[model samples]
Target chain A: MFQPSMQNIYRYFIISLLITVAVNFSAAQNKTAGSDKSSEVKWWNGFLVKMDVVSPVVTGFSDSEHFGMEGSVQFNLKRKIFPVYEIGFGGADKLSSNAIRFNTNGVFQRIGVDFGLLKQSNDKELINNMLTGGVRLGWSNFSYDLTNLSLSDDYWGGSQTLNFEGRSTTKTWYEIVVGIQVQVYKNLYMGWNIRNRHFFKEDTSGNIVPWYIPGYGKSGSSNTGFNYTIGYHF
Target chain B: MKRESGNNDYFNFKNLFNILKNFLHNNFIKSTVFIWITAVFFFSTSCIVSDEVCRKEKNSRLKVGFYTAILNSSTGNYTLSTLSIDSLTVNGVDSLGNIMDSVLYNNSKNLSSIKLPLNKFSNESKFIIRFNDSIQDTLTVFHTNYDQYLSFECGIIRNHLIDTVLITNHFVDSVKIQEHNVSTIDAEHLQIFHN
Candidate 1:
């Protein structure tokens, strides 16, 4: 049923090709410029603590059906590899158009590692800038409530109202992330990233699946999310 | 020309820092931030709320088709063929022989199959079938009903499993069960064989 036009495919291909060429060129330049200075950075170059500023603002601007806030601590290794630990809390109070209401709130955690694509420079001005790609494994455990659910027998001439409360579930998912971070001021950094997230398991039939999973957006197989973060470097 | 490389590095870092400070103060960074904010705003507002309605059939009914047995000459075996009735009237009844108010088929002409709703509250459903308004037969179905949760939008529906069938031998010869499991999905569950 879904068909991609040749023009669109060509356009996407061209864009991706351009991006690849640009990144390769930049990395090549950095490689030549920082070949001798790369050893100056230490293996453990401290850590950065960041807080997401996009989720709260975006959810507030939207219908407010969902809201989430998250923070992360990423340890820098030789200004190249980053091992990160992130935690967040998310909640939703959504009422469907048909009067079915769902409510939930819980905490979620993620552990991951990122690889910097840009070679490190000894120059302090360029030392705090990075182009990074990473993968994350996230887990959450939460309970939800669904109310005002009704079933009607039109032919048999009867209707029954059903409600499920305190139904708990555990969910695990993975994310592929790409982002850029730059030092805006002394010891202060600003960055943004886009994530493509996918769940490890699907909801089985006849199960009362939650309308929204904490930190995972809507209840579905995959979701795309964006985050803009501000961090302080130690 | 022969200065220390460390001093050259420090001078270059200072110059680069000043250039970065000037770039941050320029309108370029401000414009980029504005574009990023606009993009985020659009992305946040673009989420379309799902308006999915319950599209699956929720009614659980028993499907009965009329058939006639014909003998195959070469194989000497009886083969079943579909039979259409001229006129048929079907309605449910209680155990006391009192007909319910609902009529499933009211003089349906040239009907080969009919669907009847089973009772969710009772274990047995009785239906009176009047053929051509002249001959009548009573068909009884014994089934067990269970609840199945479909989804939040569709809620729940009662499904049935057929155990046995009892019918009066008036104008109907014999009855056969084709399929036993009955839910919202439409399928032929019973067959009525007549001459």
Candidate 2:
């Protein structure tokens, strides 16, 4: 009886120790590798550069567009504040139901700052993730082509078919963005953001409004946008 | 942790309420009320505005004026003089060789000018016009149809350009083409001269 009791205690002790070790190993691997780096890093740390892989992939499946690409670079400040710069190019060759043709290709840019919203505490587990809110100022300059447009004078005896080519304009807009980034691998992150964009002015001239704006989805006074990005940290 | 007190803070809810009360008591409320009023403004706009009340006829029709050719003694040329028909009737034909309805001006008396609509689907418009129940003429217009997109609200409109006008001469002597294009604007298109 004494020998059996001693074996049971020994077995229970080994099992508890193994369970503790396994739990600790997973927790450490899933969380940040080191907690000291997050607090010790001063402002003006290395930059985190990201590329938007979703935009190009989505444009490939777009019916109206030929292709599109977007990328961004952000500077980390105390791991709490970030200044971001984004650039993109998009174009579309679309034909309307009435045989009105619209073609355009343009470059767009956005500048913004993001604020980190993750709660900070001394005793919590170290997780390299962030919830961010940001505001952006965006602009695009482009030239477009409109063809096969017909105009007639009803009482007059003449009709004209007109084509407008290389009509250029500059558009300015603003966006409010919210997003989340999670560290998937060591020094690598995957993130997505939703943005609400509003344009300050619209081109409502005699000509038809542009069917598509470079960074904005459609040519409207307001729009919503989404981006999925993969990033690397230095 | 001690800074979370409710009464001693400038950013507290009480302070915000007081600030809003003060703002409402000032002229700033005028602009706010104006914005609210405009926010409630409603417009009955649509993608297509149906033809409702008949104010003025559509300008898509061709206008014709009747005239009599008089022998000029000085230039030895026939000049046009305005003439009115005793009784006039016009009918339009459709694609299935069916006589569509008689146009707006049917069995009219003493008409100086007549308006006729062209075919919307086909390139040719055929019309049978009778004058005084004794003289009848068939007018055929060959043209091209152009679909014009005015705007989203206005929708699409069909415009036509006349290539040629052929008519069977009964009591009519000659025909003159004044305008070759027909649209929503009103203008004289052709003049028919009587013998």
Q: Give each candidate's fraction of reference contacts reproduced.
A: 0.30, 0.00
Please write out the lDDT profile of model 1 over residues B40-158, one tens digit for every residue: 66355435535358777788889999999999999999998999999999988876778988788999999999999887767888999999999999999999978776665676678
Q: What tens-digit string does per-residue lDDT give for candidate 1 at A1-234?
A: 857743354346345534543554555566668676556668998899999998898678757788899999999998888999999999899876568888999999999988775444456676777767778999999999988877665555567777889998899999867676878999899988766678988878666788888878887766767888999999
lDDT of model 1 at residue B150? 67
CAPRI quality level assigned to candidate 2 from its DockQ score:
incorrect
Q: Name the TM-score of candidate 1.
A: 0.79
| Per-residue lDDT of candidate 2, residues A101-182 (tens digit) | 7788999999999876443323222345665667899999998887766555432234566677888978899987766676
Interface RMSD of each: 6.5, 16.8
lDDT of each: 0.79, 0.69
Off by over 4 Å in 2: A1-41, A64-66, A121-127, A152-159, B1-195
